[model samples]
Target: MNKIKAYGTESHKDDLKEMTIERRDVLENDVKIDILYCGVCHSDIHAAKNDWGNSKYPLVPGHEIVGKVVEVGSAVKDYKEGDIVGVGCMVDSCQECQPCENDLEQFCEKGMVGTYNGKNKHTGKQTFGGYSTTVTVREEFVLKVPTNLDTKAVAPLLCAGITTYSPLNHWNVKKGDKVGVVGLGGLGHMGIKFAHAMGAETIMITTSPDKAKDAKRLGADDVIISKNEDEMKKHKNSFDFILNTVPVKHDINPYLNLLKIDATMCMVGAIEPLEPMNGGNLIMGRKRVAGSLIGGIKETQEMLDFCGEHNITSDIEMIDMQDINTAFERVTDSDVKYRFVIDMDSLK
Candidate 1:
């Protein structure tokens, strides 16, 4: 193991500060990365503050990583030094599970290892994440990123990008289908881009009238104010699919009322219990509500390739490593335009 510079909190009550963390030495099938950018995620705040009741202290919270290959172990063949690559939420998993064999390691029966605060499969040590200068990961978990896109903005694609893409791809959202993206933050913005790229009539559903202009600029064909009862009723039973990206618990009943018969709305955010849902919402039209997690390595790679082809990237605000604490506060207050990405050069 090698000690590296990183920013993390020693306890739930403390703010992030510089510290040393250990990363495993490159193994025969491993690749070492010099992290260039790491995107901030809302989960980072939750984990850092122990909001989920399952967090470990000394947490280095970042998973949307984009970097350059700086070293490779003897057995590494798919990547070389100087290759642009990425690492998302998961770093390892039990490959013998049925899900892994089917390219769905995110659902591995033994549980997939998270980028941070997860038990490492190799040494049984806690995993560290991309808030540091470097990381060494197994080749199977490393992804090849497209060089054509802005690498900084591409960082969030590893997380926010895939979270929105997986559900649409699974439900077969296509041209001529009417799609609604609930909420207009990090995940919702990407949802609009992907749905538009897929040729769907994308609509941004939000409670704020102020978000309408920005929503349309992000590829949404139209906007629906969820707070406006008249607007909500006009679009009822017209949506083919809805991607709910609200990160906090709120009532989903009204959104449910807008789905067509046999239509579905998939939740990619709001991990906690939501307001009581009305059964009549589903019973009336055979509508369905579902949920999705991040995609597997194969699907993540595919999502990146798709983004490359279409030149899609998250709208981001750049910050230095020293400003992470302030950035965290801004994120919690919903002040960022979309996402925040840390430029690792400050740490170097």
Candidate 2:
């Protein structure tokens, strides 16, 4: 084991502070990363505050990690020192499950180990995440990052990128498809970019008219102010797919109404209970509403490779590790342009 420098909150109400934590030594098939940047995700705030009721204290919460490989175990053949790699929301999973066999380890029947606040299978200890200078992960769970993109901006792609990418890929969104992205936060922003890149006529559906110009700048073909009755009616039953990225409970029926018959709307955010919907909304159009988690390891790598080919990365604001408290507040207020990335060197 090695004592590594990190920043974490000791209690739910306490602010994050510098501390030292233990990371396991590199074992066979393990890769040790010298973390360069880690993205600040809204889930980090939720976990830090124990809002989900499943958080563990002394929590180190960052899952969107990117860094250089400093060491690789003897059995690791796919990566070596100096390679840029990433680790997303998951670190490990039971490989024997059907989901794992299917390359969908995110749905591991035994439960995928989260990057933070999850139990380590090997050490029987809680897994600490990327709010630190270094991390050691299995080779299978580590991702090969594209060198073309700026590494700092690429950090959020580990989580936010993949979360939005997977659903689009799964639903097979195609060229010229009419795709609607609900909300304009981190997840929603990525959804728009991915949909547009996939050749969809991407539309940004939001209640704020002021966000329209920004949405167009981010690859949205058009913007629909959801609060405008005439505007919402104009797009009714016109969408081939919708990626709903709203992070809080809200009425989804309006968005559901936008889908064409047999079209689907996938929810990638708002893990909490939502307002009850009328079943008739679905029964009438044969529209479907589903949910997706972050992609599995294989798919995450594909998403990164896709991003690399397309020169895609998140629009972000950089912050020092010490500024996390204020960043948390800003994130809660939706004050960021899109994403926040931490320069881990500041933790030193």
Candidate 3:
């Protein structure tokens, strides 16, 4: 084991503070990363506060990691030292499962190992994440970062990018299709970018009027203030697909009513219990509601490659390790323009 500096929360009530944590030494299949920028994901805050009811203490909460390979295990063939790389939400999973066999390891029948606040399959100890100076991951889980993209901006792609990309790719969004993206937060921004890139007539649906300009700047062809009945009515039964990225508990019926017959709306947020909706909302139009997690490792790498091809990356505000607490509060209040990325040099 090797000691590394990290920032983590010690208890439910405590703020994040500097600490030394042990990272596993490079094994035959391990790739060691010198973390450069780690994106702040909402789930990190949720996990740190035990909002999911499954957090482990001294939690180092970060998953959207971008770094450079500093070392590679002897058996590692795909990666070498000095490569730009990244790690996402998952570190390991039982590769024997049916889901894993199909490259759907995110749905592993045996629980997939999370980057942080999760059990390590090999050591049987709690795993920490990218809030540290370095991490050693199995080569299969380490992704190549596109050299053309800015490292800070690419950080959010590990989670937010893949989370949005998977659903768009699965539903086969294409040219001339009308795509609606609900909520203009981290996930929603990526959804808009991907949908627009797919040649869809992308629309940003949000409650905030202030987000109109920002949405258009992020590739949204149009912006709809969802609270306005007239605006909502104009688009009713028109969207080919709607990707919902709103995280708060709210009435979803309005969005449901906007779907065309046999149209689908995929939910990537709203992890909490939501207000009930009328079943007639679905029965009448044949609308469907679904949820998606981040893409599998293979798909995640594909997302990075696609981003590289398209020059797509997140809008990020870089922060130092010392401002993590402030960043958390800003995130909770929806005060950030998009995403926050931590510069690991501060940890050093």
Q: RMSD to native for every prediction?
A: 0.7, 0.6, 0.8
lDDT of each: 0.95, 0.95, 0.93
| Candidate 3 regions with alpha-carbon error over 4 angstroms | none
Residue pairs with colliding backbones in model 2 are none
Off by over 4 Å in 1: none
lDDT by residue for model 2 over 185-303, one digit each (tens)? 99999999999999999999999999999999999999999999899999999999999999999999999889999999999999989999989999998999999999989999999
TM-score of each: 0.99, 0.99, 0.99
Once model 1 is optimally superposed onto the true structure by TM-score, how far is the C-alpha of residue 211 displaced, in angstroms? 0.3
In model 3, the Cα lDDT at residue 166 comes to 96
Better of 2 and 3 by TM-score: 2
